[model samples]
Target: MDLFDCQIIPVPLTAERQSHISFWPNWLPRERADALLERSIAEIPWRKDSIRIVGKTIPIPRLQQWFGDPKTSYTYSNIRLQAVTFPEWMDTLRESVERETEERFNRALVNYYRDGSDSVDWHADDEPELGFEPLIASLSLGAERVFQLRHNLTKQRLAISLPHGSLLLMGAGIQGHWQHRVAKSKAVHSARVNFTFRYMNGR
Candidate 1:
């Protein structure tokens, strides 16, 4: 992995305040971010394949991949995913997330979007396994992508670019109140990996 000279800096996430707990802290040194991303690609057990969405099993938006656990299999939006054990790098990252959210995470669900064509629709990570008032830590690495949110009923919108090394945290109430999505782009070439850490009680 190429070493970046820039330092990992955290991005401020408070622009306008909503009732839900949502945060975007991007402070990772650029170099460290590169190293962590490279290490993750090499060390994490990422897999390439298709998944069922809606009602039918379909291939991901593009050449998508994921790293998670067998028991972590949970599905929504026709997407079935397993939770993966945390890699050392991710474990360290998780600690930071824990401090930020003041909660611990046992499983991680990572998504890789190869380019602009790849994206996720507006959906909340409010699966049964995620528990009530779940704290989801989403860390972005690689290309910059837009993260969007809208009120479930009111249709109010909020959007931000989750550049490499940025972390977006949706704490519990956000799911009940909002739906988020990663919109498709037209210019990104490199891949973007997003790790959404969660705690599942049963489902």
Candidate 2:
């Protein structure tokens, strides 16, 4: 399997002056990955919640559990978030993520896609609490799912399959220029767990 490797190059996201680089490393082995996923499942209090979009609530099949600093507990669009102290396994993964992305994170929002049907809608993490151009480091495990990105202004689409134990980082003005989502798939029988680390500013 030819996965995308790390390279130092200036990524031209768009004509807009967005600046960021993704260093996707094959850091977590299958055994360690399973261990982390199982441990996180035990620690995080997963909840199934509805999201209000344009004054209408929608079906979001997955449950989310958050941890990190105590000041940010965002539940909805721009929902305020408070952090919980990190578990040891999470702390280890966080350190690895930080090293790969070269960004510091104070919080992590974890999502458990219990089956192939679970998904996240296309949205940008552009809340006031995230400040302007916040960075997000996402780690995927358990199953491979396609993560899609669309240009908010041009409608151009890009897709990448997120395999287990892989990481993707987005930062700078990328959030302002594009929106991303993990669309549903029907061929997989197992679940996938995604952990997105962010440094949220208290709104």
Candidate 3:
């Protein structure tokens, strides 16, 4: 797809302390988005992983698949993930994002939320391996969901409705200051797929 042919604009957010979040409600065409969602569900080797929280082992809410360049393994919440080869479709999409955002990414973490029961807790992408500042490009498909961000110190909050085919960019310093999550909602019964691309600093 030609970058010039696509008109993806960012959705503005209310003024919040040290927060950088923007969204393109329709980064991909509806047909393309649906196709990608179906292919992702069929091709990716998704699996459940658990994390230790407060001395208890609990399964992570959603299924995940981590794939990227060599040595792009990542760890967080005491869970380690090794990098696996990515599919051509994902690689092409990553290039498109880089061209539009003027940024580069070497790793991708995909999350699959099955129905309303699956969700992620509030947390920042501030792992040591991500460096002091991190830029995350998150693309959503299949279903719409609400993504919330809260300030680390000010207690201010912002919420955005992320629809299918949308792209959300979390800019530098955003992760250092703001925490975000996808809350579970009984109203949503369809599945959703989120692809978050990042520049991993790993061995």
Question: Which prediction has the highest lDDT against the true structure?
Answer: 3
lDDT by candidate, in order shown? 0.69, 0.76, 0.83
lDDT tens string, model 1, 49-149?
Answer: 56665767676674333334545576765556565555567778878877766777767777778788889888887877677767787888888988888
Provide the global lDDT of candidate 2 against the true structure: 0.76
Ranking by lDDT: 3, 2, 1
Task: List TM-score per model, in order.
Answer: 0.78, 0.85, 0.88
**How do the residues 1-203 of candidate 2 rate in per-residue lDDT, one tens digit apiece?**
33457633243467756555464646578798888778766767776677678998875688887787555466556443455677787888888888877788877888999888898889987777677789888899888888888878778777777777878787678788888998888987788899999887542
Model 3 scores a C-alpha lDDT of 0.83
Which pairs of residues collide in model 2?
A: 69-83, 72-81, 72-82, 73-80, 73-81, 73-82, 74-79, 74-80, 74-81
RMSD to the hidden true structure, all candidates: 5.9, 3.0, 3.7
Clash count per candidate: 20, 9, 0
| Model 3 per-residue lDDT tens digits across residues 47-80 | 7899987989999989998888656678888778
- The residue pairs that clash in candidate 3, if any, are none
lDDT computed for candidate 1: 0.69
Better of 1 and 3 by TM-score: 3
Which candidate number has the best TM-score?
Answer: 3
